[model samples]
Target: MAVSTLNVQKCHGKNIEGWSMSITNLQAWLQEEGTVVLGISGTRKYVDSVTMKWLIAVLYFQAENPNAALSFYWEPLKKAVRVEGHVEKLSASESDEYFHSRPILSQIGAVVSEQSKPIVSRDVFIERRAMLLEQYGDGSEQLPRPKHWGGYLVVPEVIEFWQGQTDRLHDRIRFRRPKSGDEPDGVLLHQGDNGWVYERLSP
Candidate 1:
């Protein structure tokens, strides 16, 4: 058996700011339920433009093995992105190699950014960035991926695709697990009309 529910809410007179706020509120609500997975669509340039493009990040409680969940979700995301004409996964060695390939300035930037979080002033960050560049400017590959800076994979139990239509009649298709079954095989497959039906979602 599969269980699902649709929630409809009106956002009358609420502007874009309000919509953004509502998303935060919804995240808080979902967190209370259990682990909540999120997906967001946006241009890469748009994400790269901002100092932090974390608007769409998966949130789950701090766990003993947080990396486990991340690894799970990351696999399918890599596949989905590839199917949509994007690059595929980077092996651990590949990831390490890519880190070494980064420019010295970029490596310094990563270091400086990690030390300066929740920044309030632009000039301060710029100065710090410049200072790091100068300090590490021998153009050496000594810098490594920051201890806190790495990728996490999330194994999604459910994936939902939402398409907007006129008059606010959106199209939503969710895939979840059946109430009774063995664990999903975790194989990603492309399906016509159904899109990617990798797993069954609990409706």
Candidate 2:
């Protein structure tokens, strides 16, 4: 997606140096422009299962909070729409197909590692690894995709973008609404050049 630059005068008590934009706003704009399935690139930190679970809980809290910025009906907008659900497991055939397509090392690692579970000793893990190696012998054939590993689809109900400026004049934009028409056909984009783009803000 092409990013459009918006000039701002001031943001966050700083002078606007140059044009800036908000990622959330940009996403909202794109949705309005009839684009879906945006790909975002970021670092993937290895989060333990507990951390992941906690993160989900926090999201749920914000999602359920009535006064949060990300809340769906906050007049001034509080939070992004939260889509929650269990990870769907792939069918046996689907799992087999995906496993064969994965890198051999990944397959082996998945087979050997006790995901989302505690391992007491490195030696025990190594022993399990050696045992799997002996059994699989290089993982060339399709090894079943782990049952714990699956997928979840998050449908973003709102997307906002903000761009930082030199003097703290950041650009902010938001996209959201009744997602009714066909895909990529009825998305709406709202552009906000100044901080006062949307009305109804209290002093």
Candidate 3:
């Protein structure tokens, strides 16, 4: 999953800020200056790398051990889903609610580590975790959520489904918001629900 900060304009293109976080059953990270590429498949080439704070984000899901051969020497199909979207920062109250719901140890980890910053050694985290554990180990004490910590919501504008084929003519289907002057002729582009459009692309 890709996430970007809201309200901070023009982060350095190379530096992306993020930290590992687990909520409920999902684990994700935040990227400060993430890049999102547009125009996956079509005649019009849009090869620009868009680096913006809130304009782009992607959620990618890939299969595990897809390259390995299956039973009877059959090759397994490699599949992935990519979603690109606009990012919106969650409200402070919402952030607080999610923060407090985390396990105590996870909460401590978030507070102990300063993401994208340099530290002399891993022992820094070990020591800090130990100290915090001693202080807030009991249920009586609660670790306060850091003001800088929060969450983001990625509203998808485009989504692509990909499947690898043995002939290398892999299948790709993209669903996205209809751009201005888009007309589905029912062959190359098909009209979809809620002002969306779908198209099959050449691999």
The local distance difference test score of each candidate is 0.34, 0.36, 0.52
- Over the stretch 47-164, how does candidate 1's per-residue lDDT look in tens digits? 2211111222311111111211111113333222101111112234634555566677766665566332356777866898787666667865366655433322233445555444
lDDT per residue (tens digit) for residues 77-105 in model 2: 43233221221222346445555565666
Runs with alpha carbons beyond 4 Å of true place in candidate 1:
1-61, 64-98, 101-103, 115-124, 135-138, 181-203
Candidate number of the best lDDT: 3
Residue 137's lDDT within candidate 1 is 74
lDDT for residue 166 in candidate 3, whole number 0-100: 84
TM-score leader: 3
Of the candidates numbered 2 and 3, which has the greater lDDT value? 3
Worst 10 residues of 3 by lDDT: 62-71
| RMSD in Å for all candidates | 13.6, 15.0, 12.4
Q: Write the per-residue lDDT of candidate 3 for residues 1-203, one digit (tens) a residue.
A: 32222111235654342322111112243343222211111111100111222112221111100010001111364876655665445556866787887899988887887643578999999999999999988958878887545554545677678888889998989988899999999999999987889999999
- Which runs of model 2 end up more than 4 angstroms from their true locations? 1-99, 137-140, 179-203
lDDT, model 3: 0.52
How far out, in Å, is residue 78 in model 2?
22
On TM-score, the stronger of 2 and 3 is 3
